[model samples]
Target: MAAEASPAPYADLGGENTGPVYTQSKGDTLAVRGYDVVSYFTGDGVPVEGSQEFTVRYEGYDYRFASKDNADAFVAEPAKYAPAYGGYCAWAIGANDALAPGDPNVYKIVDDKLYLNFSEDVATKWNADIPGFIASADVNYPTHAPDEHFQD
Candidate 1:
């Protein structure tokens, strides 16, 4: 019998994808819909930018926070405060560290650590090799440099 060829060891080989990705910023706790940060599983979205409490829906999920302070706290340590994949797009992470938009449903917790990706297509690839790809991505991310990865 003839030998079979191995599949390419990449989430997205072409790396020609455009999508939203999880962003890490100082005050990024505010949800895309302008809702305050809250336990994805527990509370509804509150207005983190102000002291007022409000509710908002994202990706078909409802979230809430008691007050702006609570939302700020949640945003400060999202990995510890938000649900898995609740704040980041998963597929993006799996495929060449592409920036994926946040998906509240798709998530994974490895060694109690949270990571996010872009889309379901990207996520499927990410789930294939959690440790290996993540390690490589982490290593590659820092040294990727602005000019090499980004052209502004």
Candidate 2:
């Protein structure tokens, strides 16, 4: 099942949300909607809900983990685990230069990086041309993404 998303709090930037990370709402610091990012790479390769007990702050966002080991793993190399494009829907950023909420339940690991999509349908579109989209997003994200966490 898809996780519930919080109401968007920031005003749209030309009809697109602009930020370095995708939080559910303004003033919310939880990354990946509190899903364990490390879990996406470890063990069964299935994402698991993180515990508040094991949380780490990185790049101005709070990342939760299912266990201390996972947290430590994240701390060791955050860039390795952080979702590409700050957890925004990969296809959206790549195809549209738009910031759409990335569903943790719908994810893909590409070139050893975790990438999230808006939904299964978007994932389908993304899967069609991964390399091309990545190239476009690579050029678009830096231009569209703001340096700050939240920009209104």
Candidate 3:
């Protein structure tokens, strides 16, 4: 299907939004770099690039989906699909409480929540101590993150 412009904003899907969902730039509201967040949980667990035609705006960010089904799934339960730590690099948030770009291609699903890392190398480090890092991030993220997207 063809893509379209993002639709009007929807109600803020309540969650402990650590920070603004990561986007390519300050003006960019596309979460997960336009990847289908729900795709991470379905099929082979490989995330698929999303189309603007299946977009949903939630929590001040626009999430795209590979299909209408995925979009509808997100609309039903955004917190379940939205990336943790506001789509920031998992390692950065967990280890340093810093905001770093999370590569959509490098991700993990732990305890049913999706987490993203900066790169393969970062993912390796993060994978070494997932639980520990999550514990640290769970404490650090809400306290340190500003209520805005990174001004890249």
Candidate 4:
């Protein structure tokens, strides 16, 4: 028989994927909603739309880029561009211990690590105690890392 589908969509691709991939569920619009992850750090703190032509696949998920330079930067240092908590809401990870989709536009960088949030409100709260929240999320992350998204 085929393996049972997870109540959640989390999958451990193991070495096959090279690392953790963002939850690219079937028919999901795009990775990080097609926003250029590199743009958040390399230029003005804004979400830049990525093009389909300039794309790279890492960890079995496709990340689109606004330019070839951005795509190359990601290929060179993926950890520097990929968001923390597997692109889940940072506040939800620390506060509620939940997995919520992070809005690519609502983001922040602390200690050179990118963080995403469900909304401005959650980002605000997450900003209140960045260190504390980071500590909490750091602990919770490993437990939840294997799964891309959680239903409950």
The sequence of per-residue lDDT tens digits that candidate 2 reaches over residues 1-152 is: 99986444221112222447888886787889999999999999999998877877776677788998988888788889989988888999899988888999999999999999999999999999999999998887787544434334
Best by lDDT: 3
- Per-residue lDDT tens digits for candidate 3, residues 1-152, read 88985455433354444466788887777889989999999999999999877878786678888888888899899889999988989998888877899999999999999999999999999999999999998887877544555554
Model 1 alpha-carbon drift over 4 Å, by segment: 1-79, 82-91, 143-152
- For each candidate, what TM-score against the reference? 0.43, 0.83, 0.86, 0.80
| Model 1, span 1-152: residue lDDT tens | 98985332211112211222233342232333333344333334222332224333233233345554555554455446443333444444434654335544444556655554555666788788877766765554444333221111
lDDT of 1 at 130: 78
Question: Distance from true position, residue 18, model 1, in Å?
Answer: 23
TM-score preference between candidates 1 and 2, better one: 2
Greater lDDT among 2 and 3 belongs to 3
- Candidate 4: C-alpha lDDT: 0.74
Tens digit per residue, CA lDDT, model 4, 1-152? 99974232122222233223345464353568778899999867787988877766666566778888988888788878988887878888888777788889899999998898989998999989989988998777777645345552
Better of 1 and 4 by TM-score: 4
- Model 3 poorest 10 in a row by lDDT: 9-18
Flag regions of model 4 displaced more than 4 Å.
1-29
By TM-score, the better pick of 2 and 3 is: 3
How does candidate 2 fare on TM-score? 0.83
Pitting candidate 2 against candidate 4, the one with the higher TM-score is 2
Model 3 regions more than 4 Å off: 1-18
lDDT of each: 0.42, 0.82, 0.84, 0.74
